[model samples]
Structures are given as C-alpha cells and as structure tokens.
Target: MNTPDTHSPVLEVQSRRRPLAWLVAIALVVLAIDLGSKMWALAELADREPVRLLGGALYLSFARNTGAAFSLGSGYTLVLTLISVTVVGVIIRFASKLRSLPWGVSLGLILGGATGNLVDRFFRDPGFLRGAVIDFFSLFDPYGQVWPIFNVADMALVTGVALAVLLELTGRRIDGTRAVKERKTAGPGTRDKAEQA
Candidate 1:
C-alpha cells in the first residue's frame, strides 16, 4: 500500500510560524509606542498645567492617579504596584501560548501599561513605590461634564481589551484562522478535536 502525498496544501497547512512572528512584532511595536508617548507626555506637561490642544472640548491636562481605573481606590499605590508586577510576570511566563495578534497585542498593552505606571511608582515625586501615575488627556462635555484624565497607558489597555473582545466574539482561533474553522467543522463537545484544531 502507498501513502498519500504529504506535500499537498491541505497536508502542509499544519506547520506555519507567520502568525506567531506577526503577533510578537505587533506587540513590540505597541510597547515602543506606549513607552515613547508616556515619556514625551511626562516632559511636555512638567508643571501639571493643562494644555488646550483643541480648545474647549478636548484638553491635555497633567495630573496623577494613585489608584486603579478611573482613579478609584486612591492611596493604594502599593497594591496597584504589586498587581502590575504580577500581570507582567504572568504574561511573560505564558507568552508562548498567545498565538494570535490580538492575544499578543493584549499582553503587550498590558505590559506597557504596567511599565508606564510602574515608572511613576518608582521615580515620580514622593519616592519609590509611592508615586502617582501621570494622566494628561481629558474630555469635556458641552453639558458641563468632564471625563477622568488618562494617559497613553490607559488608552493601550482599553484598546487591547476591545480588540480581544472582538476577536473572541468572531470565533477567531488563537492559533490561526484555519484552526478556528477546523475546530468548528469538527463539531462541539469534542475535546480532542478542539485541541488538535
């Protein structure tokens, strides 16, 4: 008996590194952008002055947050610091499993955001592990409402979350698009099928 040809496209589809490499590349790019922007913001808004870049509605106001999202839980810089460190550690440890761009980007955003705030806690005024994160962007409403100030790091975190959600909803596989469809084709409740796909 003769075996089937193994060089055909279908048989050759299982081996590929393009997706993994692309994911890593995108992650690095985002990390660089996040870090660079934060550095620039720190220098440009040194005196905690608000820079009105577009007049009334949008402004770049320098401030600091020593808490979690939306400035909640203030005075917990140590807690926040520990959480950030844990997140970074976890991402680095499991990076090999982040097989898609969205996963990689999410981790990258998280890592960069963590580093950004970590920088403040380590070097900003009030000494090590007690500094507040610098936030500079604000949205003003015509109805007299103001949004919380945020920095580049916050933006990355939000964007990454949004993308991850989108990818998950679309049934996009972490390994690749082919893997996603393959799993679906194998039907539900099949553990082996899911794993191989």
Candidate 2:
C-alpha cells in the first residue's frame, strides 16, 4: 500500500494568499470610508462654525489641525509630513508578516488613518503640503472643557490600536502558551511538536 503524504502544499498556498488579499481589501475599504467622511465634513462644515450634534454631549465643529493627533506640535507641518510618509512605508513593508486577521485589521486601520490625515496635510487650505486637517468630532464637558477635536481618521487609528493590543495578548496566551508547553513536554527529537512550539 502506498503511504499518503502528510503535508499539503495547496493548503499552505491558499491559506497565505487568501489572508493577504483580505488584508489589502480591508485596508482599501477603511481608507475609502475615512476619506469619504472627511469630504462630507468639509463640504458641510467648512464655512460654518462648530455645532452641537448631541445636545452638547457630542459636538461637530470645524477646525483645521496642523499637527498630529490632538493638535500637538501644531506648527511643525514638515515633521508631521515626514512621519506620515514613514508610517505608510513601514505598513507596506511589514504587511506580509502579520500572522492573524486581527493584526491585519489593526494595521489596515492605522494605514487608513495615516493616509487620511496625510491627505489633509497635502490638500487643505493655507498652503500646499502644510494644510491643516479638518477636525470636527468632539466629546466635551458640559461647561466647555475642550477635548481634543479629531477626525474620522483618528477614530480608525484609535480603534485599530485597541484591537491590535487585544489580539496580541490573547494570541500569546492561547496559541503561544500551548506551543511552549508542548516543546517542554516532548524534549528534543519530536520535530513536529518542536516546529509548532
């Protein structure tokens, strides 16, 4: 009787290729939504002043931020521009190394957010490549303790980071912990268990 091969190359090919495509698709979708919302905000609120969207709980106001999140380093447009470029480059370079869906989604969110903000910096008013990003979403105290105004892009980035953290913690505990245990129990000659470890 002929012995069946233990490994399937086709399964490996499908596994790797499918997930990578999914990641790229997710990234594109996020970027589309983020940019679309910003465009809508620009058209609706550009000339108008800030307005309360939820009875002072959530406010929609228009302001152009020339800095990173929360308006930090407000005048350092060149610095922010460089940072954005670097982020995009890194995302592209390391996208293939992400081993899980959660990681891919997180990276996609970050990429979309960074792209959205970078678009504003390049295209908004006051100068080319030094334009402020439009930030209108705000959560504030009733008496007007100002929270940092942010845009849709910022929202994506925040959520993505949160997801990435959760995934890393969970993955380490689940798959990684089990693999480590298997290695210790099997000692050295069990090649399959060692590989999994």
Candidate 3:
C-alpha cells in the first residue's frame, strides 16, 4: 500500500504563508518607526521652535492634523478616522491572498501607515476617534508654506500606494501571476505573408 504524501501539502501551505509573514514583518517595522517618531516629536518639539535642517530645506515642526494626510479635509476628523479604519480592514482581509513579494511589500507599508495614524485617531488628544494625528516633518518651510507638514506614516502610505500603482501598471498581480496580454489580431497583409511563408 502506498503512503499519503502529507509533507507536500504542508510544504505548500508554508510556501503560501511566507509572503504573508513578510508583509506582517514589514508592517510592524513601519508602525514602530512611525509611532516612535511621533512620540519623540510630541515630547521634544512641544512649545519649541522648528528644528531646521538641510539649510532650511527641511524642518521638524510639531503640528496636530485633524484631517487626512497633508492636513486635507480638516474638521472632518471622525469621517477620516472611519475611512482609515475601513481601509485597514480591507487590507487585512486581502492579506490572506497575498503571494507576490512586491505586492506584499506595498500592502504592508500601506497597512502599517494606516494603522499608525489610526492609533493616533483612537488615542490622541481631544477624544477617541476624533483625535488629531501628530505631524512634524515640514519641507521648504517650518509653517508648511511650501508644503504641508507630514509624518512618517504619510510618507510610508504614499510610497506604498505609488508602488502598488506601478505594479498594477506593469501587469503584476497580488497572487504572483502576471496578467496575460491580449494578442493583436493579424492584419490582412500579415496574414497573406504568413500564408505565403
């Protein structure tokens, strides 16, 4: 009697899970960095002047954003919080289907960034779900004159979304499969040439 090959199935399962593990690891690292930076900003930059760097090209200026990234949609904190929560949920649900390394990395960054800001929205000043996000990095000016003040989470989120878009444009999919391109129909001249050949 032949024995069942249980090891093959187990190995296949592990292989499928490897990408998910990578995603989780990347996300945790991003979340930790963003949260830590925000904590440091709140402690060291409070009531202090902006810290200039790169000959004033960059400034670390503490600011509280009650809206989405770059301070957009201000005064709608609750709405933004709910939207973020929904995004996080969708990402988590889709994680189980992740099998491509690039897709995993992109989604991981987005998940981490979203979760980082969500933490602030849930626990920061003012109240739960209405709290503001801590932003400290400013470009060109300390008062966001040239660019909106942002945080690490915003950076990660933007990078992730950009990467995802590039992957999609290049025919990469989340399940490690390249999208099949449709073949062009042969023109009359081409068909005649083929027939002659």
Give me the candidate number with maximum lDDT.
3
Residue pairs of candidate 3 with colliding backbone atoms: none
Once superposed on the true structure, which residue ranges of model 2 sit more than 4 Å away at CA? 1-7, 141-144, 171-197
Instruction: Arrange candidates by TM-score, descending.
Output: 3, 2, 1
After superposition on all CA atoms, what RMSD does each candidate show versus the true structure? 5.5, 4.9, 6.8
Which whole-number lDDT from 0 to 100 does residue 16 have in model 1?
Answer: 36
Models 1 onward score TM values of 0.70, 0.77, 0.88
lDDT tens per residue, model 1, 1-197: 99987557764443334444554565566557656766777788766556665666777776778886556678888888788788778767766555555566666666666666677778877778888887777777322147777777777667766776777776665554422433445556633223333
Alpha-carbon shift of residue 23 in model 1 (angstroms): 4.6
Decoy 1 TM-score against native:
0.70
- Scored by CA lDDT, what does every candidate get? 0.66, 0.71, 0.89
Residues 1-197, candidate 3, lDDT per residue (tens digit)? Answer: 99857459885587568879888998999999999999999999978999999999999999999989888899999999999999999989988778788888999899999999999999988999999999999999999999999999999899999999998887788877777554557753322111100
Kindly give the stretch of ten consecutive residues in candidate 2 with the minimal lDDT sum.
Answer: 172-181
As a whole number from 0 to 100, the lDDT of residue 117 in candidate 2 is 86
Predicted candidate 3: what Cα RMSD to the true structure?
A: 6.8
Task: Predict model 2's lDDT versus the native.
Answer: 0.71
Q: What clash pairs does model 1 have?
A: none
